[model samples]
Target: MNQPESSKSLFLGGAAKATAASREKYVPRMGEESALEEVLVEDVAPVRISAFVGLLVAISSFTAAVAKPMLVLPVLAIALCLFALRKHDGRTKPVGTLAARIGLVLACLFGSTGFFVHHLKSRTLGNQAVYFARQYLELAARGEESLAIELQKTKPNRQVATMQLNEAYSQDESAMEQLENFRSGAYVDVKKAGLDTEWELDRRPRVFQKYGREKVDTYWRDPSGKFNGVIQVELEWSPAYEGEEADWHVSLFQVERELIVAPSVL
Candidate 1:
């Protein structure tokens, strides 16, 4: 009976050893799982930051399409997203990568749109200048000297007014004489040539070296599409004063008359 009891005790001890070996074998895998969880947590932080920045860039870019002052915001957001993408090379989160790409595309699209709007505004201004020039010539042709002079004096900045008055009286004395000629019908030949006819722009207007001034070139064509001559109109722009809207006025008007100097007989 004593021998049998000792053998039973030895078998129980061996079973306990086997259980300990199994637990030891699994310890490394548990450690590897814990390490993987820590890596995943670390990668998520940058993705959250990038997503937030991308949202801001999209909103600002839309606003800048109408509001000119908000143009700088998209530029800043794009820079920050690029930095985040570079910092975490192999472990870059998907959210972060997507955000960065969207931000870059929006910035480019809005920036180009802003430039096109500006160009259209400039062209509209040029067309307006040409219209005013034609009006001035028509007024003078009707012998409305006072009205023509009043048209020339249309709203101008205080500084521009002083400079123009000085130039009109002191430097370009012939300016008044030229207007007198127009009032006296010296340009009747030109009037017959359709000088008072509506003209279309020949090309894009040019801004001169002088500030607040633009030069517009226009042409009048016959019904048969025959090129008549070119007209050059100069305009000066003035900022709106208190209780007044901004205005543009004609400063000079000249016509490059198309001459038919017959070829000299050879």
Candidate 2:
């Protein structure tokens, strides 16, 4: 009976030792797993934040491309994305970098395209303004008074007509006759002293301004290809009746003769 009890006690003691060894190994493994989980949780917040910021940058870039006025927003977004990317590391770095790059490319493309279109439109309008000015000046110089007057925003009033007549008849005895002819609503022949009726444009018209109104300057040359004078015309939008095509009409016309000075022999 004593021998059997000793053997059973030894066996129970060995089983206890094995159980303790297994617990020691399992506890360390559980602790290690918990630490790893804590590390992952700590990393998640930063990655999420970076991704969110990157999404915002992309959206702003797209908006900037569509609406040029919103370019500032995309610039700000790019700055923010860069800052976020700097803070990001490991798995999040690539995502943040990609977002920032995409935003930058889209912003550049849309912004440049918008500016180019705007400049092209301005150039086209300027060309139109210059053409209108040239046509008006051509008609006036050719003594097509009725056709030239049609280009005016409004018909010249009596006061304006009288002033023009006075300027045209400033010198010579025929001035009195021409003034009488103008008052009688007749086309006074001032071809000899007035603008050269046979002049043609010698160079591209210089556009001074293009907005609600436009001003254009053009140089003219006589039949001999000598620069005769400069013509400036101001144009404004004509009144649009319902369903009528939009148009511009001449608001003012001015001509300046080229100065002729004899060379002094030195």
Candidate 3:
């Protein structure tokens, strides 16, 4: 009545296969907990903060490029960064988290630089214009009638020319008041104009004569007595790119109307 050995062995083998199948179908509770921990580590990685900072810097740079009175933007940006850091309790986040801080600094630098450049351009343009005007008077003094006449023919709004010329006189007088010997001139002459006055050459005497979509001004001293000019100046500030540099130009002229024509041009 005892079971055959082969049959017993078969029964044991069947039990073992059933046990393996059950284990495969079941998941360990501890393993599930470990998987969740791994997911959390990935989700809270510092890379998230860095990516955000990169985006902030890009936006800041773009705004800085267009905002007028730009000096204020950088200040505001800096203030915002400090506020954020304070809210975070001064904790050091990822490197990208400091993008705003760096952006603020760069904004300030670029804004200041642009302002100074414009300021210098304005000042130099005004002074040079005055110099050419005064030089016209000097040319008149030396009987260089043709050159002086040519100036009037090469500028915009004769009235503007006269004003700039007077401005030069005022500048010289102001320098005199300061006990400084200053020699300068301003000139205005129509280079090219149309019914609507498409172009002009003002604030000249420090420019050159050239052909383009830009305004140019220059002051030249007629050497070899051919013109008896005092200062040979050429200036072209405005540019013409995609019609953006419409404020740029090239102008050339001679300056000689100086009661105290300094030994040289500064």
Candidate 4:
């Protein structure tokens, strides 16, 4: 009886040891699996060329916003996709790794610069346009139909040259001559109404402001129209403020003008 009892006890002890070992192994395996499941998708994701993409997205959106109402949705979609790409794990890759990084950086730099540049220009043009429009409206209100007609003929639009000639005349005849010789690009500095010192602009038109009114440069090119039509004008303007000294010179307000066409017409 004693021998049988000893054997039973030994067998039971061995089974208990085996069960403990199995439990230990199983616990670690389960824990490892749970840990893997919790790992984030972004943490181990690959790199992508997203900075340039973001810039392009922004540019496209801006252009669409300027050009047509229908372009907004597509532009917005592109922008959203770019935002996602930027947030993705792949962004770092395109910016940091491989020869493609150079192109990506260039694209980012130029694209960003281009977007802001266009925006500034548009805003400038819009403000000028608004100012002109107000003047025209006031004339019309006073029953100065002739002047209003002239304003309409000269106001800026997709055909900016016409607006240039329309707005070219200054009280000073010398100024008019100066304008007729102007050769700058269309650009404007837009700022908060009171903060004229701060330059801001847009690359498109505005109903309340101006659109193609921002001049950068002027050159004559024949439009598809009547042959030998002398009704041509050229214009140029830019937002480049002429500043000198680290902090001594006051902001120069240059409204220079020029006519590339020998016979500029309204």
lDDT digits (tens) for residues 1-266 of candidate 3: 89999999999999999988766644344344365321222222143343344345434544444443454555555555554444332233533446655655665666566566656655666565555444444554554333343344333322243344444434665424422211223232211111122222222433222353223344333223333334434444443456443332224434435576558777
> What are the per-residue Cα lDDT tens digits for candidate 4 across 5-32?
8899999999999988665434332244
Model 1 TM-score (2 dp): 0.45
lDDT of 2 by residue, 1-266 (tens): 35688899999999999998665533332244365322332233343355456556556555554444566665666566566556544442344566656655664665566556546655765678767765765555467554454455343322344346434445535655634443343122223324655555657665445554445555544554333444446666444557665677776555554679999999
lDDT of 1: 0.57
**Residue ranges of candidate 1 with Cα displaced over 4 Å:** 1-99, 154-201, 204-229, 256-266
lDDT of 3 at 83: 46
Q: What is the TM-score of each candidate against the true structure?
A: 0.45, 0.46, 0.32, 0.28
Worst 10 residues of 4 by lDDT: 185-194
- Of 1 and 2, the candidate ranking higher by TM-score: 2
Quantify all predictions' global Cα lDDT against the true fold: 0.57, 0.54, 0.44, 0.37
Which stretches in model 3 have alpha-carbon errors above 4 Å?
A: 1-86, 89-96, 139-146, 155-266
Model 4: per-residue Cα lDDT at residue 96: 19
Residue-level error in angstroms, candidate 4, position 53 = 13
| Model 2 whole-model lDDT (C-alpha atoms) | 0.54
Top candidate, metric TM-score:
2
Model 2 misses residue 155 by how many Å? 12
lDDT, model 3, position 154: 30
Query: Could you tell me how far off, in angstroms, the CA of residue 53 lies in candidate 1 after the best superposition?
Result: 11
Q: Of the candidates numbered 1 and 3, which has the greater TM-score value?
A: 1
Candidate 1 lDDT trough over 10 residues, lowest sum: 36-45
lDDT of 1 by residue, 1-266 (tens): 35687788898888989987665533332244365321333333344576558656755776666655566766666676675456554354555667777777777677667656656766786677667666755654555454444454556423343345435534556656755654454234235544445445666566443543344444333332433555555676665779788786666555655668988998
